[model samples]
Target: MDVTGKVAVVTGAGRGIGHGIAMKLAQNGAHVVVADIVEENAREIAREVESTGKTSMACFLDVTDRQSVESMGESVINQFGQIDILVNNAGVIGAAGWEKRETASEADWDITFLVNVKGIGTVTDTISPHMKERRYGKIVNIASVAARKGTATSTPYGASKAGVINFTQSTALELAPFNINVNAVCPGLLWTDMWERIAVRFRSKDDYPDELTPREVFDRFVKARTPLGREQTPEDIGNATVFLASDAAENITGQALNICGGYMMN
Candidate 1:
């Protein structure tokens, strides 16, 4: 687990799981590049990393835009010399609560695919050249359980994540000869901003126990579904990320690891 001097680029690392991953990598002595669409949040995490006595840089990145992703990669290369790890953690929960595929408009599908699926392609493609040249890299993609288990109202999100898993497999196969390991981490519901938004959908309409906040309700749902009897946290995801990014997982690639507390046994 010693990652001293290793450079890591974590996308959408402003808050939640991405932020936790970046912080954990930094804590482990990696020179972390925190990339986010929100520049301010990225800078905030960079500051936090510095406070922890580690090297970090904040970059404004739009993973869906090829130019932006390339420019961010350039910036990291200029500052850090090389990229050793890339974490595709930036994603969206496209059209939450609208289960009916027939009800989802064309625009909804486009936006979801652009950000969740194509964005991953853009960033990974931009960084692949660098990784290939180095002949060593570790890639960790953030997929979701919805990708494996199709959920109601999750068509766009699920489809995009399923794409991520396949993309990881394909990319891993291609990068293996170059000594790069590509894998994915599938996370179940954690207490992130996305969940907060999802919670709102049930707030006014659903009749539940009076003692529960929307978050508590969501927690109860997970506890009932997950055999682990508890909800996941950003830290749980982060720890898995750090391990996957480290040499400890060097032999593991093209595989999707579920951090769902056995919510979906496969």
Candidate 2:
């Protein structure tokens, strides 16, 4: 899996899975653009990428804000000339620990969709036309295994991911004729800030109990749900992402590849 001399723009790349993806791409020879809402994080990641002997730049991107997204998009195009690979990794699982399942507010739903769903479209719109002009591009959307099925825990999250899968398929078709491939990666359990929040929600349940710490709750879920009995890491997701963005996956598009440890298969 190589992306030598290519240009990749990764959103939410300041940390976690996004950081991993940026590093992997740079390690594989792609000049990376570390775009994140947090300018400091983006700058830090960009420096990290540069330290690996690859050229990189930092861009501030708020996926929910068109102006912010557009500004970053323009900056990347101006600096790199073109974006050969685009990874839509910016997303949110908006829910409060206090909010009950049946009582999920419209505010939560709106924010989740705005970032997880519409955000992808906005970023793609800004970047894809350039891809079409060049008739070459690779688009990867970071979805979740939750998209494969519904979860009583976070209704909006699962639904937003499901929407991501659908968007991947639809955009794949639209961009295929232009020689651009679009795919989705449905990552399994990866311990991140988002998962920490999920763990907090789990503790609120009757089964988790007060004695069970967040890590313990997360471990219990990972052991029960993952057939391989191993937690998925940012590096794992990064590997898959680099593969999809590389020429090895030129023919693959409009598909959601599951990165879970056999926890989700469809």
What's the TM-score of every candidate structure?
0.93, 0.96
Stretches of candidate 1 exceeding 4 Å from the true structure: 95-103, 203-212
TM-score of 1: 0.93
After superposition, candidate 2 runs with Cα above 4 Å error: 95-102
lDDT measured at residue 253 in model 1 versus the true structure, 0 to 100: 94
Q: Find the candidate with the highest lDDT and give its number.
A: 2
How far off is residue 113 in model 2, in Å? Answer: 0.3
Best by TM-score: 2
lDDT of 2 by residue, 87-137 (tens): 999877884543334456887898899999999999999999999999999
Candidate 1 clashes between residue pairs 3 or more apart in a chain or in different chains: 99-153
Backbone clash pairs in model 1 (N, Cα, C under 3 Å; residues 3+ apart or in different chains), count: 1
lDDT of 2: 0.91
